[model samples]
Target chain A: MQIVREQDVVPFRNRVKEFATKIGMSLVNQTKLITAASELVRNMLKYANGGKILLEIISKNAQTGVRLTFIDEGPGITDIKQAMQDGFSTGKSLGLGLPGAKRLVNEFDLKSKPGEGTTVTVTHWKNGR
Target chain B: MDRIPILKMGQFLLVTIQVDLYDRLALNLENDLINMVSKTGARGVLIDISAVSIVDSFMGRILGNIASMSRIMDAETVVVGMQPAVAITLVELGLTLQGVYTALDVEKGMELLHDKIGTIEHPEDEEEEAPHDDID
Candidate 1:
């Protein structure tokens, strides 16, 4: 688990980029993964005081991919379905945080409780599957 | 006080960001660009971001804000030299940078600025017989 802080954003992105590159992911796919990672990491810092992220390189049936899971024990999302909608941001942002990140990755999973916390998992396959 | 330098070129202001900008540095750039536009009466502002490799929502907002603020001050802002990866990332992040002009490179951005705001007439183009007063 990696700590998520404002200062950690750039270094995190760089590390993710390096990992994606090492896995032979295309430039476009690498960029997408890094971008999604950036959004989720920032959300951790914004919602929770701070959080931790777990990065793993996974493979399934000879297909390789990168997976990132963000966990925070802050005030969790009340209505996840609504929160997943674009232009639906609790923060005074452009409201594209959740939905935008979902679209950029191959797979997305989010679980949250009103008072417990939020866990976001996203994965991007090397071949864009 | 780490700040990007803003140079005056004729009727335009040029800024090149060669480093990764955190929140404070980005905010300082926005403030400096606006003030320079006001103080110099610059008609166009060109920002070169070819060297910048990473940008987040905050940085994206700063770019948009600088464009809007320059517009309010009667100056046009053109963002130039965005990498392909950065473009895709911004689009995925839902930042289209609406109302802000963009170019592939500095030369094209300069041309675009000249189109929006006419070029500043050079004193060398004036006749020798005219007043010998120095404008610089």
Candidate 2:
């Protein structure tokens, strides 16, 4: 668990980089996860109080990948389902936040409760090798 | 660094965009770059990344968008002066850029400009996106 903020993005990205490196994560995949995490963490700081993110390596039967869980105790999403749409956003972006991140990672799961907290999980694996 | 000004030779306009291009700024810069390519009347654009420590996934997305919009705008976007460290970092970051022309320096950028320079018209319009307050 780590507090989230704009300044924390660097550390979060670095954390992902360190973990991703040990996992032999591909360059493209690593960048995607880092970028996605950075954006989410930024949101956590901008919209919520500090949040914590957990980065871990997961290995399944004959397969290995990285798992990142970002949790924020901020005002939760107004709509979980609509937030997944590309053009839907409560922020000033092109509404590419959640959906764009989804395009980059293998598994994406998110839950949010208004006035409570928000959590997003994304996992990236090697090329099915 | 002082902002690089857009230059005009005959009808062709060559503009330079050199931002650190990191973090979330990378994504917005990409969108701006793409829109500049599509809507601007310029014939050629030279993007210098020497100041950038690295180009990441967000930057990669922008580069792809620029290439796609270049075709739509009937213009050529040449990427210039990517530092070795930046290139390495970009590779390590696993970023990918497609359909972009690259040059080593302004001279080389000019050389690439020679082909499309003659097709340039007046600087027809500026970007339409809401200006990012941080970028000046």
Candidate 3:
């Protein structure tokens, strides 16, 4: 899904919720996943001027998880570590988007190059460990 | 431009959010509600969010901002009917919504608002009123 404007955020969230529900994710887990997706989608729109999101469902053994990858080609983060820290924001926000998103998912990965772009991938397991 | 309606009931303003709020709509609500409070001189604000399914940090901040703004305007804000899942997600998102009041439902929220403003008349007290008081 391409998230290029503020209006796109809601549809992106609905898509994420649909995917999470398809996997029979618990309400709590689904909410967490969707909230994390909302934060990332808004971040992309805020700092990166919008981006594309990829959703996938993966399973291993008896556990199923939903994974989302947000790819943005706008301004990238120079210091990913600082971006992941709480109370750090370049925008006029509460500075909880990145770190808060990380806490909601089971796995979080971020890659950014100052001139290239930024990509964030988050995964939430059905029955979280 | 879609807008959320803010109902004025006596000294209180009521907002029932029945749709999934996009960022823009949420911001607009924050703006409109604050303006309404100031315009009407409302003493309390009640937001019923039972239909809302998810709340991220931005939305959470918006709610907190509304509470803070209303506080400065001398109006108490109560967020009612938060879904259990949304509440859990909010905490995980590191948004405790401090300084905001919350209740389980709209009725309870209305009661809380009345209690906060000291306007609720007991049922027994109403029953004890003399019949001559109804002449007006």
Candidate 4:
């Protein structure tokens, strides 16, 4: 379990990188994971108030991959469906956080409520790893 | 036109540029990136492209340039918050960036900078002579 505090984002990144290294993710996949992880982590700070992230590596024989989970406790998203749509961001930057993170990996799932916060999970196969 | 100019934020370097769909500006962005990377001697970069809505093939090429530039500079670059709609449109237009580093927002991008740049302990760097003047 990796925890990201309100003001500390660098530790979270190093933690994620360390986590990826332990999982034996290839350089390519590691970069992808890093990119995806940062995106999710950034969203926690920007949209949500703050949150913690959990990264778990899963392997089965010839197949190896990573599972990322982000849980944020904030005001929660008002529109998850619309948020998933391309070009839909509540901030000034181009609205590609969720969707771009989704494309980096093989599997992605996100859940959020208006007042319940947001939880996101993503997985990338070793082939895609 | 003059240089697009590079803006530095302590450890984070930024270059705010506008380019046509042609490959010219995109290539220029690449060259400017090299100069900025040399000058700042920082570990990472945050490219905030919130103003750009249209991403052409030339724009797509910028990612590859960033990736290569980072490697040579012993630094890393992370593009933050590019428009997702532009992403889709670029891909649909048969454009792709094979190797690139990207983040969702500035916060996370900072995190990456820390991870990559944190190893430097500058106890002697201030006293040492820099090798290049190309950075300025």
Candidate 5:
């Protein structure tokens, strides 16, 4: 697990990019995955101070994909439904944070509590439509 | 203290980000670019991001802010040499960068800016007469 912070954004994206390239992912696909990762990591830093991410390569039914789980132990989200809305943001931004990241990948799972923490898991499948 | 240099061409300011842009650096660039646009009365601006590999929402917002700020200053902004991957990522992120213009390269970006603002009166025809070896 790699710690996610402000300075770690670029390096985290680079590591994800390398893994995507190694999996024979196209440049476009690689960018999408890395971009998604960038958003999640930044969220971890912004809302949770800093967190750790688990990177994994998974296979099922002769298919391969990359999975990332972001775990943060800060003040958790109160309303997951409203937070996933396209234009809702607690920070000074366009509020495309969670939804935008979700749009860039194949699978997304977000679990959070009021005071516990937040864990967001996302995946990108190779040649996934 | 790292600062990205903004070059003043005939009537346009050129900024080529050759290194990874950190949060502070990006914010600083925004402030500098806006100030430069106002002080120089530049009609157009071209930002080359060919060397940049990754762009997240923060970087996307910075670009958008720079373009918007330049527009308010009566200066047009053109982003040049965006990698195909970055472009794709941006689209997925739902950041169309609505007001900013984009080009395949600096030369084309310059030309686009010229088309938008038209040619201004200058003492010398440095644009056409100057050597074009720097555009790679």
Candidate 6:
């Protein structure tokens, strides 16, 4: 999915919700997944001007999880460590986008290169393992 | 181009967010709501968000901003009908919505507004005189 504007956020969230529901994720877990996705998508738009999101469902034995990867080709983060800290935003936002999204999911991974682009991948398990 | 309507009830402003608000719509609502409060001198502002399911950090900030702005303008803002899932997500997102009053439902929100601002005077009621025959 391509996220190029603010209007794209709602439809993307609805798609994620549908995917999560298909896997029988709980309401709370579904909300968390959708919220985390919202933060990451907004960040991509704000910093990178737009991005591509990949939604995948992974299974480990009998457990199932939803994974979302956000890829942006805009200006990459020079200091990922600082970016992960709470209240550390280059924009006028509250700076909870990155770290807050991490707290809501089971797994979080971020990769960025200066003068290149950024990629953020997150996963939420149905059973919250 | 989509806009959320802000309704005025007596001395209060009511906003029931019935759609999944995009960022622009949310921002527009914040701007329009403050203007309405300032223009009408409304004593209280009730926001019913029962239909909204997802509230990320941006949405959270908008709500907080509305409350703070309304307070400075002498209007109390109450956010009501937050879903349980949304509440949990908000707390985890580090947005506690400080200084913003909240209620479980619209009716309770109205009661809280009345409590905060005292008895409300309906503009329509003031147009007609109540029978004074029983008074003294």
> Can you list the residue pairs that collide in candidate 4?
A126-A129, B39-B135
- Models 1 onward score TM values of 0.87, 0.59, 0.93, 0.49, 0.89, 0.93
Poorly placed runs, candidate 1 (over 4 Å) = B120-136
**Predicted chain B of candidate 5, TM-score versus the true chain B:** 0.86
Clashes by residue pair, model 5: none
TM-score between model 4 and native: 0.49
Model 2: CA > 4 A from native: A1-3, B1-45, B49-109, B112-116, B119-136
What C-alpha RMSD separates each model from the true structure?
7.3, 11.8, 6.1, 16.3, 7.0, 6.8
Task: List model 4 lDDT by residue over A1-129, tens digit each.
Answer: 444453355456567667667766665565566566656776887777567677777876677777888898877888888887667778854466677678777789998888879999988776673
> Model 6, chain B: what is the TM-score?
0.86
Task: Give the alpha carbon lDDT tens digit for every residue of B9-128 in model 6.
Answer: 998999999999889999999999999998999989999999999999999999999999999999999999999999999999898999899999999999899978878676665666
A1-129 per-residue lDDT for model 1 (tens digits): 565556777777878888898889998888788878877887888899778888889999899999989999989999898988878888877777788889889999999987889999999999878
Q: lDDT per residue, candidate 4, B1-136, as tens digits? A: 4456677888678765443222345566778877778887866767766555445333555676687777778877777676665555545434455656666777776776666777545556655755656765
Query: DockQ numbers for every candidate?
Result: 0.43, 0.07, 0.75, 0.02, 0.65, 0.72
Ranking by lDDT: 6, 3, 5, 1, 4, 2
What is the iRMSD in Å for candidate 4? Answer: 11.3
List the TM values for chain B, per candidate.
0.86, 0.63, 0.87, 0.71, 0.86, 0.86
DockQ of 1: 0.43
Tens digit per residue, CA lDDT, model 2, A35-81: 66665665677678678888888988767888888888889898888
True lDDT of residue B84, candidate 2: 66
TM (chain A) per model:
0.96, 0.90, 0.97, 0.86, 0.95, 0.98
What docking class should model 4 receive?
incorrect
Identify the superior model by TM-score, candidate 3 or candidate 5. 3
What DockQ does candidate 3 score?
A: 0.75
Q: lDDT of model 6 at residue B111?
A: 88
